[model samples]
Every structure is written in C-alpha cells, then in structure tokens.
Target: MKNLAESVNIEAAEIMKIFQWKGTTDQLTDEEKTHLKYEIADTLIYLFYMCDQLKIDPVDVMKAKLEYNKGRHWKKDKE
Candidate 1:
C-alpha cells in the first residue's frame, strides 16, 4: 500500500506541473511530457500489482466505484 501510495503521490506531483505552468499540458517540454507519461504508467503499475496481490480485479473495482460515484451528489465549490 505504501509503495502504491507513493507512486500516486509522485504522479500527482507530475500532474501539478501543468497547473504550475499556468497553461495546458501542451505547454510542457517534450521531456517533461514524457516524464509525466512515465509517472502515470508507474502509478498504474503499482496499482495493478497491489490489486493482483490482493486477488482483486482492478477494472471491476474501478467499475464498481464509478457506479457508486454516479449515485453521489457533489456540491460545486462557490466560485
């Protein structure tokens, strides 16, 4: 779980680069874009490995969560 969480954190940091740039991902350099791609892949790899160890189907769980979320009422933040 720790490894999976850490990988997600690293991916989040990479994603934040887009917001930090004050523009879209296209504003990032080619190398930065590739690095973000790798970070996302690393997070997915960790998630799948953890799910495999627990004998869980990642896709099934994700589908279930999506269904659950569909029933949820989210309050939009005041702008």
Candidate 2:
C-alpha cells in the first residue's frame, strides 16, 4: 500500500512538471515523454499489485465509480 501511494505521488509530480515546466505536454522532449510514460506505468503496476493483494477487481471498482460519478456534478473552475 505504501508503494502504491508513493507511485501515485511520483506520477502526479511528473504530470505536474508538464504543466509547470512547459505550457503543455505536447512539447515535451522525447526523454521527458519517456519518463512520464514510465511513471504512469509504475503507478498502474503498483495499483494492480495492491489490488491483487487485496483480492480486488480494479475493473469492477472503476465501473462502479464511473456509474456513481454519473449522478454527481462538478463545478468548472473559474478561469
């Protein structure tokens, strides 16, 4: 679980760099793109490992969450 959390945090940081270091991810260098890809893969790997350890089906959880979100409304940030 700790690893899963850490992986998510790392992934978030990598994504933040896209917005903070550059205007968008579209202009990321090849190395930066590769780094981001690996970070995302690491997050998914940790997530799946944790799910397996807990005997959880991530697909089912995501499906349920998607359905639950359908009834919720999000306010757009004032830009």
Indicate which candidate wins on lDDT. Answer: 2
lDDT minimum window of 10 residues, candidate 1: 17-26
Candidate 2 clashing pairs, residues 3+ apart or interchain:
none
Model 2 vs truth, CA RMSD: 2.9
Q: What is the C-alpha lDDT of each candidate?
A: 0.77, 0.79
| Residue 38 displacement (Å), model 2 | 0.6
Model 1 regions lying over 4 Å from their true place: 1-26, 77-79
Query: What CA root-mean-square deviation does each model show from the true structure?
Result: 3.2, 2.9
Candidate 2 ranges with C-alpha deviation above 4 Å? 24-26, 77-79
Error of 1 at 75 (Å): 2.2
